[model samples]
Target chain A: MTKTTSDITKRTSIGAQRNPASEEAILTAAGALLSEGGLAAFSIEAVARRAKAGKPTIYRWWPSKAALLLDVYHRQKGETFYADTGNTRVDLIAFLESLLGFWKKNGGEVFRSVIAEAQSDPAALEALRDYAVTRCRASGIILERGVTRGEIRADLDIPLVMELFSSFCWQRLLTGRLDASRAQLAHLVDAVLTGFASKESHAQ
Target chain B: MTKTTSDITKRTSIGAQRNPASEEAILTAAGALLSEGGLAAFSIEAVARRAKAGKPTIYRWWPSKAALLLDVYHRQKGETFYADTGNTRVDLIAFLESLLGFWKKNGGEVFRSVIAEAQSDPAALEALRDYAVTRCRASGIILERGVTRGEIRADLDIPLVMELFSSFCWQRLLTGRLDASRAQLAHLVDAVLTGFASKESHAQ
Candidate 1:
């Protein structure tokens, strides 16, 4: 059984009544189905069947297929481990490497599902944008630290920079290219950051 | 009635058999259908019915929906005009502004369909990637000209730069965000080119 986004909100007030274990089971099952079957085979019914939960249980946690998948995507992402080494370039590269690794290993399929769904469904696009917003803010920590340490310009637009960074990753994945080599990733971060650090940008 | 990739190749050898007007009508119908209803409403059947051509007429030229849609995308892009001012900065801003405008008005819907279809189907991905490759090269001209004029770094990686630039556009489109303003586009181009130009990058 899965808990809907709102259900989780409600359950937060009283954790004793709802079993948290079912949420894990449901998400795990959804991930398995996605891994083996792709988006075409994933559905609320299929997830419920695989998890031995009623369809209502899945519905309670997510209102639609995209919703369920979004939860799965976030859950999977929450587990990818990376750290700040107190160096902007070093930290950014490590962060992107972890991200690219995760995408190659897991996030690619899930993101593909979300992006594909977003193409036609406005709701899915909103959810994806919401997710992107969170990740962008989180990733901005690298630049934030960089600015504080004087490794990055104080006036750099963090949001636009992050958008550019993610755009590269998503574009490559959507195009079915291999995960970029560390060298390529290094080039990207260096290029964007260099541009930010330059006097020409500051003059504007 | 639009020509297939192979058909175009064969046509180069034998140029007399094709009717340019029907080809134009089929492509125009496809662009309109994609504009009005997106991928769901775009089909060999719908296109044939709309163009008053037989299904075989479409298949004879396109072979598949992805191919047909690719042609439509290319046709749309071919019509967007932008100048290559001798100044790299000016030319890039103009180019990106044109792209952003195109995506906002028309390319967004069509690109969303192609990107969405590519996510699910390998063949569609190949077609979309082919389009991307061509566009990437074409856009690379800005950087190439910059290098020639001693404005951009001579040793910069063109392919990586193109990936970054396209990533920004596709990312915005996929996330359902408005195109970055021209000032923002200029900022991005300037930032990226600055990064490429900075001596630190060359030291690597």
Candidate 2:
């Protein structure tokens, strides 16, 4: 869609210099649109209209809808709590609780839209993978702390463990199970931390 | 979209009686469409055109696009292998290998679309959860065999473990990581079966 004169004036006043204020406005508008209407209501056109910024200006920075969605997701995630309670199981459980709670609040829908978008858009898929990698590394620190404290096996695959944790959360989020109880989260963490093998097998 | 005369004729001859041939034709057409175009290319209209049937006929039986997608998914899943070697780890690894292989082939895209569709459609989400419950119960049978063989702890939460396994596979599939190796799958199973507690924690 061609930019109208008003769009030009808006762009010049707010976004021409790539100022943080314009970026915040765009991100806020996108998040609001997503929260209000879900993925079906989200689009460059919608975001531009709501933000009063020109489409060309948005494209100048975000590149794709997925990128914008990812930013919205990250912005919300910045408020998520990651626990470090000096105990791996406890820390893991607390981390899960905070993460799931954040998701239940509103972050889940935003992230869900991102996942849905990734299914159809190559750029979205790439953005998703890259985001996953970054989150994996950051979250692996929990496992690392456990290793350091001798609470977890040093040889344990931290990345795999992180994937297991994330997969559990992702499945719950996608399947409308974000209301998983604290006890359930604890059970999951305990299962991961302590093997499920029968005592006899462990002895053997 | 209104049905043409040929559409009515095709529907009457093949689908009026809900014959096996027509059901198979519609399902086959749906699967082919999903496989070729992913979720974006899938719809009742497209399936009607491809199968030479009316959209009403397709909807009459499937009810919703999600229902149709679920059927297409189940049809492909029928070919998946679920092992029962009397060993939980072996069986789990083998099952993952077969499931991942199936996804890497074509099932991943179809299933991914189902997940994507569920994000925006309540009917799709319901269908997805219903399907997950069925799959979880069936797959839990593998772990039950382990319990019967005294290889697993009877007190263990079967449903939770099942969720872990499915969640792992779902994450890998959704993130384009369906190529996970046997070694990785084995590690995951072993972690679950043997627990990850440090030596000291186990002694306690």
Candidate 3:
């Protein structure tokens, strides 16, 4: 829920002395390998080889490939914010437009690997889950206001709402069609708000 | 576009006649590898080794790993359908509920790899894009009906809508929180439907 991408490993005990120079080298090497060949070409051995750091040093700091990737993403993640325009509609659309643009510009590849990495490693899965929820939590205020104003049903499941928002944007970014106009985003916001609004509950 | 998973080669003119028996073995082998280790462990060498098929054979059939994964998904894809029942709300909710349960039960791993593979490989990305569009096409009819009946906005961008729907479901499934209660899903569907409903456009 914090404003910035917190270093993923600070939560876990990586068991290595904090050496800024070594850490920088490892991250740089890993990032290069990931960029050049994606996940398949990424390995601790390859990273150690490239970074000229010992395998033990790398292992001392990070537990697995995914953990390393998580740190990379955390360090690299850019700003993701939603301004509190007081109008949920305006806030949601603007947040989504920026969110889509951000992912397309920088976060798509990292996001893809994190999601894929989560598939096999429980730790990675947990880290990715935490990352996603934390990202979603930033936009929580919008939902809170919508609920307060009765624009969104007070009983609305906020987490599910976040899931809907994230998934929608992720889908577009993943598929390379995220260049939706603000007007289009406006339409989507309207539908989602209408779905979450109280007026339609009885109708359903 | 196609009701079933079409072979990648069939579209590309691979020229060599695909032997059904070898094709079945490669798919089975690749599926197992993907399931066991996700994308990291999925490789032509590993698959060829396990299937006892040559590397050339796998390449002759699937131009890339993503394509192969797509074919596996097509072969193993479980039922995803919605009966008209005259209500878009009811039909969409049912479709999503089943979609969630199906992936939890069977499709999660394969789906994960295909998505991950698409991140770096242009061919795989194209395959994934095609697969997503093809999958979305089936659900397009639902939106069409909603438009005709004035339930959904007549000018709704169907492709973007589909991307939103798929991404939401996929993010949940990918994150493994797909066990959302039917009531919860109902809220999401309601929210999404409301977002796309015709009345909102006028309101906005």
Candidate 4:
């Protein structure tokens, strides 16, 4: 029987040492293609052509397209800004503003594509969940700082609170509301920080 | 030039009065297809074939696959439960429980598909946004009741608060976390109702 493309790919990739330069080229090309055409125009064949890398080589390094997409996203997201303003509300708002700004610039499309991919691929979903957990833990430092500073309650659920904040951001990004004003962000922070119950209700 | 399928469909659909029976059949078939196979297997062609209706009939009425999908979602979501326990926290929790239960039952798959569709189609995005606004308004009644009963602050941002609640639910649903326990739901409600700030900070 003739060797199929998968057979050839597996044969070629076996014991082949990964080249860092090729990986960088592949990632850069993937990012540019995604930015230029969005997810609909993204494909491994396209990435191979753009990066001058062989298709089997791309597949050998990245197990799946979702894996490659996730790497590109991580590469694009160089560093997350964590603001500590000596106040929970201010710190949270500043952090969100910085995050949203990054999203509006380029992160939104890439992250949105990841989320959309998750809807159809279980591996993508797993990757997204793992990434979200890591980011939440990193961002939870703000709330932890608030706790240490005596601004927030010590017993507060950090994971849940961070989930709330991330959910708000995700909704905005997915719905194309990345331009949320500072006032709106302030309102969201206030709602989380101060609650909405009347003073009378709290007293009761 | 030979008459194309589009021409035939357009010619056949123009001035053709809608049959409620056929409409019901189409909606029913679309819902069934989605339930069995999810979005990957969903299409107007499959819907038309399943409904025993011509493609033109389906296209003539629904206009687009997104329109038909939205209709199926609406039809599947018969009525939303609005709980009023005379307490904002209890009412919100109960309402969310009802909504989540409905989502877990069947609405989750349908709604997830719609959200996935919105990611690629601008029309679907618009439809999703319009539907969200309408649903938010409908659900805002619970918060409004709280305002009337003096449980919540009169100046509270109803739309914003409802948005937070919806965003939380959407995140959970999208991330396959619809199985949130009652205790977790209570925690969310408490976080929204009591805030996370320490009493001393509030006093200061």
Candidate 5:
């Protein structure tokens, strides 16, 4: 697992040789298209048209339509962290709160459309799965750190915990009830962390 | 939470009776259409025509397309519990395993279309949300029972726990890699339960 984490880290830098400017332009255009008209409006042709780049340039980088979307998901991951708040409970809550807020403030609309497309399209589902796995792996780092520090249980099921964490966001995202308020987030963290608490000590 | 569960159960039964026969027919047609054509091929007209029922009847029962799809989801829930195996760990695993099996048996087609429809269509998302909330509330009852039986932590975050459980299903549902084999399920349950374990009895 540790090796896998390092490998994922290494792969992140491998794709750096591609023209960053073109990739950025494509992502920006794609984001705009996604926001303006949802998945139906997102097309390679439109992305090229919006980015002022040729279709060949777009196709050269991304293998398919879903690949471009996944690039966006990857880029977003580079910007978010799971445990930066010092306190594990606070960090968990803040991570979720920020994610929910981000969804509502920036990512919600595009995500909704992505989810819709993933439902019906195999390609889009692949993109979403990639995003989910990537995010899970990233969050695993934080949980692993928590485990190492004895803040979280060492024998914890990282994938399941990550899945649980991710699901909360998905539930809120799908429902459009993404509230990042501290109180709500605190409650969520408290509840989840309680699951990690040792039962015997609490019995006393 | 118990009250909420009862309310949903009551609503479901009442809702079931209103158009049980027509609803079942529509769902059958809709499910078939989804299996064959995905979201692109799903439509009220197609369902109505296929079910041999009038469009007006479909509309009368379900206010929107997503609502019709949701009825299909509800109907699927009525089918059977995948595996009980007695142990909570095995039961959860069996449930997830069956879920994955169902998708594979259908060629990973039905849910793919449903997810796609859910992404772009607000109605679809709403239906998903309604179904999710209802389902979560129902699962919460199971958790409550677990708590009562001393199998699960009393302080577990009900909503968060449910989210975690559902997310595993969603990830598998979206990715078509629902690898809930016996070993994988054992690992997952150990990790989750360990993470949720109380501090006094850390030996397990």
Candidate 6:
């Protein structure tokens, strides 16, 4: 009986079972304000008012406006890589497809505002940088696995490959000239794959 | 005598001769402000005060802040290219080297600020988009020439290729993870070239 009581106490203390409702509400209100009025509309007082929560509660979790904005960026623009397609080509295609889908569907406004805020705000800039490095590592893992399987060149730099893929998506996002036609995506996937394969195979 | 008189009239009326001293003063003042204070310091009134010129004089030539900023971006960024180096390998190397150099030396702050401002300001965003598309065309030309010369795949999407190239630089810039290391730049160029080259050639 004593052990059981202590176990329950530890689990609750960890806060894994804490209410997610307030957090969700705050994020939703913040997202609304960001899209409607850019970063200027996102003040601590306003967020608390919108979420029907106390200012102290909001401050208890997030240290600054930039931290809260970073949390929102993570929720909106986060990438989860699934590269177990067995074939490297299939895996790479899947990755690019999911990535492009996110870029097309959900990333427009959030990414735009984040980019804007990151320039003047040092904290936002750090968040953006940390996100990039993490994403690069995710892609690098897949490329490295491909190398082990002899699908990609042994001497290839996985980090750079990841950068090239990221560079394409980010360029379009920032410049507002993204064309997501099937043929274009296909061409990009094929060209990138071709370049990663060995030279002798290229001549054939 | 009539021809000479006509030429003189055309030159004087068009104001074809730029006042070197004024241009120098404006560029110098603009550079200092941009480097020191980011985009907020680049207003017409601010520039006029710094350059000791009237706001009307600044407005007379630049039309708006975007155009003025663009002129500054051009001077600082210098030039980026993906020229045909007779071989795909050399051309790609030169392209990456020049781009990395530009990003590190001149584009770090101004481009970052420009991109962030583009997100919030519609007009600035449009200008950035236009500049990106036009400049990217230079890289496209190199890739297209490679295809024509049987060095690269002919079925490439030029726009996507340009995006891929820019994404790397912009991501690093936004994130402030730009390490201007020779090995890193070289690796990026190599990986991208291979990724975009013909499949048969890559197999070798």
lDDT of 4 by residue, B72-187 (tens): 88777765566677878888998778878888997887787777777878867766766665565666778778888888877766766688778878877777778888988888
Residue A150 lDDT in candidate 4: 89
Q: Where does the lowest 10-residue lDDT sum fall in candidate 3 chain A? A: A1-10
Off by over 4 Å in 3: A1-80, A195-204, B1-62, B195-204
Off by over 4 Å in 6: A1-41, A44-64, A76-87, A90-94, A140-150, A196-204, B1-41, B45-63, B80-87, B141-150, B196-204
Clashes of 2: 3
- Rank order (by lDDT, best first): 2, 4, 1, 3, 6, 5
Lowest lDDT block of 10, candidate 2 chain B: B7-16
Give a tens-digit lDDT track for model 5, residues A68-127.
866664565455656565556766776787788777777676666666667657776766
The residue ranges of model 2 lying beyond 4 angstroms of the native Cα positions read: A1-62, B1-61
In angstroms, the error of model 2 at A31 is 5.6
| B1-204: candidate 5 lDDT, tens digit per residue | 436645545334222235768767878999888767876788899998999999878777676787776666556655344343435555666666666676667534555555566666777666666766666655555456556656667766565466667666766777656766667766665666555333532342
Model 2: per-residue Cα lDDT over B1-204, one tens digit each: 123434322222221357688899999999899878877888899999999999888878776788788888878778346677777888888878888888888778778888988888887887677677556656766777788888877776776768878888888877777778777888878877877778887777
For all predictions, the C-alpha RMSD in Å is 7.0, 10.4, 6.8, 10.8, 4.3, 9.2
Worst 10 residues of 4 chain B by lDDT: B7-16
lDDT of 1 by residue, B1-204 (tens): 123335322213211244678888888888888778877799989999888888877777665688788788767777344377788778777877777778898777778888998988887887777667656655666777667766666556665777777777788888877657777887776666665222433344
- What shift in Å separates residue B62 of candidate 5 from its native position after superposition? 1.4
Better of 4 and 6 by TM-score: 4
Which of the CAPRI classes, incorrect, acceptable, medium or high, describes model 1? Answer: acceptable
TM-score of chain B of 6: 0.66
lDDT of 4 at A129: 64
TM-score of each predicted structure versus truth? 0.76, 0.79, 0.68, 0.78, 0.80, 0.70
- Which of the two, 1 or 6, has more DockQ? 1
